[model samples]
Target chain A: MTDQASDLQEAGGQPESQDNETAATEPGVPEAAEKSGVSGKEVVLARDVSKVYGSGHAATTALRDASVHLHEGEFMALLGPSGSGKTTLLSILGALLTPTSGEVTVSGTDITELTSKEQSRFRANRIGFVFQNFNLVPFLTATENMLIAAQFASVPKRQAQDRADRLLEELGLSELRNQIPSQLSGGERQRVAIGRALMNDPDAILVDEPTANLDTKLGTAVVELLAREIKGRGKAGIMVTHDVRMVEFTDRTVEILDGVVCC
Target chain B: MGLAWKEMLRRRGRFLSVGIALLLINLLVLFLVSQLTGLDEGQTGAIRALDSDLLTFDAGVDQSLFRSSIPVSDVQEAEAVEGVAAVGPVGILFGTGRTEAEVVPDELFDMSVFGYEPGSPGEPAGLVEGRLPRAGETGVGTIDETVKSDGVEIGDTVYFAESDRPIEIVGFVDDSTFQLQPTLWVELGTWQELLAVVRPERVGSEPTANVLAVDVDPGADPSEVAREVDSSLPGTETVTVDDAIAALPGLSEQRQTFFTIIGMTYLAAAIVVTLFFALITLEKAEQIGILKAIGARTRSLAGSVLVQGLLLAIPAFLGAAAVTVLIGATLPPELPFAIDTGAWLTVGIVTVSVAVIGALLSFRRISRIDPANAIGGTGD
Candidate 1:
């Protein structure tokens, strides 16, 4: 067993042996492949990524030599405490922030080297994000929020509408399609956010603290649905969370501490 | 675009305040435009409507029609000049007139007594009611239609307060006004008699008129004819009707002042719209961050902001125009309130352009919004 896995088991207070129920597979290996004793394609790869925020004496390091990856259908939990640089690494992988030094390959593109506009387009087409606070546009309806993702990728309106309708139905939010964020409950709003993320049928998903505003029961239900989506759709996903309970929903857990990553 | 419109519709209450402010600004601008038009018409309508192509004033009087005193013989000399077709003397006397019956006591109507040849260059062009005064007629005058609002009618005798003289309203003329007062067109004899009674000192050794109206021959240049007339009559300044109107005392200054105020108003509107959107952009910084994170382009976001500003400004301008028209219809006619559609259209175009510019001014803040804020440090 890897020392990181042993450390995770100890920190999680689990048994010495990881069973099928607590499947802790390789960082970039599909869960189904592990179960079937086969291998799958690696979908997300980050190599020696580091992020520095400033310059000279005022410079501060947010991430250091972080390396992680996710395979097709793999759901990974990025477990970390406050200021552990997990979000920073996620941001870099999402093409939202440029790392001081790193190679981030999502799907097939080296996003770190792409221009700002190209990165934005790449994010819209290949990567989906679910913000912690469910940042749906307050004035837009649930369906519109979902359609906005497609709009960013310049999808045809008819096609986008069709996808939005399917997403809303799949997320169990069909009846509340026309309801804005204010009218939606906490869980419903999160579901809308998820619908938005999946609208583009992206290659990967990045979820940030999906249950920070929900109760324990609702939080678990949300995480379970997220894992099911990633697995059933054969897409890679990374969920950044500090909750140890939430880690069980993921196929693997990558711990981050003091700007360092242990996968 | 749809998102911006949806936000505006859903949060209409929040936008209504700024909408109202823009509406009030439009109203003020339109009203000022109308007032400016009315004032121009009231001050220069009589001169503008004259049948002559030019008017000759005493050079020493600085283009003041009432202050100018030209000898009657100057008309003959102006008519004798090359390219001159006809010339006539025009006298003016400012006074208040009331009906003999005194139906509305103390509510005197302001009137300017204009004396000219009945069928000559200075005659009122539009005689809407009754017939013109005869060449030698006295104690008979054609009054402006505006006096009808104050109960004056044909055959009614109007008593001039300054001279205590009575003149019969033989006809009514349309759009004849001078210095915001309705005009009474009468024969030269009648005007001279009133002028003599009001200011005997003005009755010099020879008959005189306030100014000489000169008609240019067909195919002749009015300016050239004016220069000839000015040279012939040594102490006189001859100008085309347009130049004469432009030289009206304080007219250009008044228009300049009004335009300056209107310009400042447009500036204020731009600033208000810009500041309002800036604050709103700040308030929605989180939403902007999320949009950026979702791959929304900065140009698209800026376009949405511009669309929102237009959505507010357009309706506001339309509402203001409608209200301005309604108010124009209800205002007292004597107050000189007139609506000019061309002016309103100009204002509308300027207003929309200003609103668009204001919307663009807030784009820097929008472009600066960091998409990383969507995740924030808490997620780490």
Candidate 2:
């Protein structure tokens, strides 16, 4: 773990946030999102986020006091273990969920506070999501997968077609446009998923452990492609992963332990 | 196609299952309703063709066919009543043998034979065959005419099934039936020799006759005149034209039973369509969520789901109509199926109404799907 962390530290292509650097230099304390410079351009901010399910004492806390800020053009990795609120934070970041308390800001808009319709429109225009399970609709072809994402973005079919073509081409998959998800290889399918996430040129991309199913070589390549291509577009990306190897490709590393950040 | 429609259609086996069920329900409803409506029209037409107004019968005699008879003098007595116009005496009987084409009429039906006085108000309007019967000749019914079915032509001699008397075919009219039997009209005087002889206690007096049909004056109240006529007769009942028609042997009861059957079938079809749509909505929860997540309006989604339910139902309705036409074509006239504009319109309205009701179930389920669950979050 230590060796991989060091190699990842050099190869990860990102520095810790200014506050994270300070905290790392000193070590040992629980810090909130405000204290973590973590390239804080404020693309995404969760102020005192809390999500509780059920009622009474039996109620479970999925996220408590979870706060974050994703910056513009920065590739940030959310490092954690299994059941450590990785997916929960991504949902909040993508505007797919509402926090029980506090607010989430995406693209200068407070998403959790938006009406259901406004929230939908906001997510459609500004947020992109990647799931660890490669959640491309199985019935759709690779090109159609991109087209469908563009559909939710409310782009006209003609323009969506053009964007879908460009994205598939950029993903090195122009030739596999007609293949369904099941027909594509593991890495090819993941590339298709990335193209789908990038189809509408959203302001930010949220990936929930994208490489959890891939081997080290493939996962490394996925991380490299997302970080380089995503940042090149002047868009921020927040990836939730337990894999230390992802640190090489990211612009910053955020260590989250037990719903709080550890610097 | 929308994704919801595409997904439902893509599953061929399931589509076929739902479609087959709908087809059966539709067919049942269509055939049953058509039969019910047809009977109503047929009974009315049959009554209309007789061309009579008010009728006087024995007070509280069992029913019209088995009604107690009154004297022929009762006609003059009714005609004397204020507001009553021409009054005529009529009698009915049946005999069957061979038709003009040599087909055994008895094997086909128990043909009815009605006898009416000359210039009687109760005469059938017209005929399909030759002419009205003369005093010396026999007259045949209209339903068996060659113009109707085969070569049972006017002026052709037809023999009674068991009686030795043979009659010449006469002109036939549409919808002339009594006691569910198609009528062959003969002159009233000829019928007396065949059906009655002098009674011992009432020797030399004219034998009992069926009833007196009273036609009201142009601006007169027939029911009131009929009541006056009843007061004049010692033991008799007065009924309006409609009441007399209803009293016909078995027409009303038969029609009522058929209508009940049809109503039940329509309800059954509605239930089946509703059940299928409910199951379909349940299966599509995840897809519904995806739509919700992507900002599909609840109304639009519900409308599309309803549109699918309608799509499934419309074809079944068409199938039902087709089957109704096929079945209506084969029934014998004795069955009195009145397939007409009213019946068809009723069926069309029912089909749409039931389909709309069936689709409402899916609408509720779609509205409740959370957009968050569609994104594969914590919700199931």
Compared to the true structure, candidate 2 yields what TM-score?
Answer: 0.75
- lDDT of candidate model 1 versus the reference: 0.85
Docking class of 1: medium
- Give a tens-digit lDDT track for model 2, residues B1-380: 35546555656577667767777776776666666655554444434555778777888785464345778887877778888878877665554445534555444555655566766666666565456655445343334331245355666665444444556665766656544445666677555644543222322357556777678899888778877888988788878778877777676887678668877877887887787778867876765675555445677677766776667777766776777677778877556555566666776678767878888877877787876664334311
Colliding residue pairs in candidate 2: A11-A248, A12-A247, A12-A248, A17-A38, B38-B338, B96-B161, B127-B172, B128-B172, B130-B154, B146-B150
> What overall lDDT, based on C-alpha atoms, would model 2 receive against the true structure?
0.66
Candidate of highest lDDT: 1
Shares of reference contacts reproduced by the candidates, in order, are: 0.79, 0.18
Ten-residue segment with the worst summed lDDT in candidate 1 chain B? B98-107
Docking class of 2: incorrect
Model 1, A1-263: lDDT tens digits are 24322222222211222233233343332333343243356889999999998899998899999999888778899989898998899899899998999899997788889988998898899889999999999988999999889999999999999888876766667788999899987777877888788888888899999978777777876787777666655568999998899988888999999899985
lDDT of 1 by residue, B127-221 (tens): 89898899998888998899999889999898765565679889998878989999988899989888888878999989999999889999999
* Predicted chain A of candidate 2: TM-score: 0.81
